[model samples]
Target: MATIFTRIVEGEIPSYKIAETDQFLSFLDVRPTVEGHTLCIIKREVDYYFDLTDDELAGLTLFSKRVAQALKQVIDCKRIAVAVLGLEVPHTHVHLIPVRSEQDFHLGRSIEVSPERMEEIAAAVRAALEG
Candidate 1:
């Protein structure tokens, strides 16, 4: 069965995509921890992060680094912190969240964002990525 991340990659599920390559995809986190919280995942479905082959792992991180750089260009945060906790869904993925302080990493402390705002943010990130 395809994981949720795979579904997003395959267009079976919708996503606010930030970037895409042959092997990876990045998108805005619908339940963002911060304003520009994004999720990066390998195109292939893998249950565990450590289970990915070395090449796949490298590709995912490199792709995410590019997304993080683009994310920082638009979001007003000190830095983008990466987290790889896969328990939420059965897909190996990375969370690139904008953080100004230690408290910003609190995943449970998500703020509600309107769908229009989400589209706006997603467009900003996409423009940054393209620029």
Candidate 2:
């Protein structure tokens, strides 16, 4: 069975896409920790983040860094916080949250964003990645 992240990577499920490459994909989290919160995942479905091959792991980190940089361009924050909980979903993913203070790191305190706003934020992040 394919994981939900696999479904998103394959377009079986829709996502507010931020960036993509042959090996990885970055997109907005439906339940955002902050307005610019994003998720980065490997195109390959891996159950654990560490289970990825060394090269795959390195690629994921570099790819995530690019996405984080683009995210920073649009989101005002002291830094982009990276989190890898891997408990909410079966697939491996990295959460990139724009953080200004300790409160911004609260994963439990997710915010509900409308579809329109999601689209807008995704576009901004995508544009930043492109430009």
Candidate 3:
């Protein structure tokens, strides 16, 4: 069975997309730690982050950096925190969280963001990437 991230990549599941490339996709985290929390994932169904090839890892990091840069432009934050926890979802993903301090990036913590706001944030980040 395809993982949820793969389903998003395949268009089976809807996502508020920030950016995409042939090998990567960046989108808003529906259950976000902060308003602008985003996830950058490899299109391929890789189970673990360390299991990816050196090139794959580099490509994902570079792709994520682009998204984070755009994310920072639209979201107010001191820095964009990055995390890789592959347990919840089998597919490899990088979490780019906008944070003001140490307490802002907890994995189990999430804040409710409405659908309209999610799309608005997604649109703003996408525009930042293009502009």
lDDT of 1 by residue, 31-121 (tens): 8988999999988889899999999999998999999999999999999999999998999999999999989998877888888888888
- Count steric clashes of candidate 2: 0
Worst 10 residues of 3 by lDDT: 102-111
Top-scoring candidate (TM-score): 3
Ranking by TM-score: 3, 2, 1
- Summing lDDT over every window of 10 consecutive residues in candidate 1, give the lowest-scoring window: 106-115
TM-score of each: 0.95, 0.97, 0.98
Better of 2 and 3 by TM-score: 3
Instruction: Give lDDT: candidate 3, residue 46.
Output: 98
Give the poorly placed runs of model 2, Cα more than 4 Å off: none
Q: For every model in order, what is the number of clashing pairs?
A: 0, 0, 0
For model 1, what is the error of residue 62's alpha carbon versus the real structure, in angstroms, after optimal superposition? 0.6
Q: How high is the lDDT of residue 37 in model 2?
A: 93
- lDDT by candidate, in order shown: 0.90, 0.93, 0.96
Clashing pairs in 3: none
lDDT score of residue 12 within candidate 2: 95
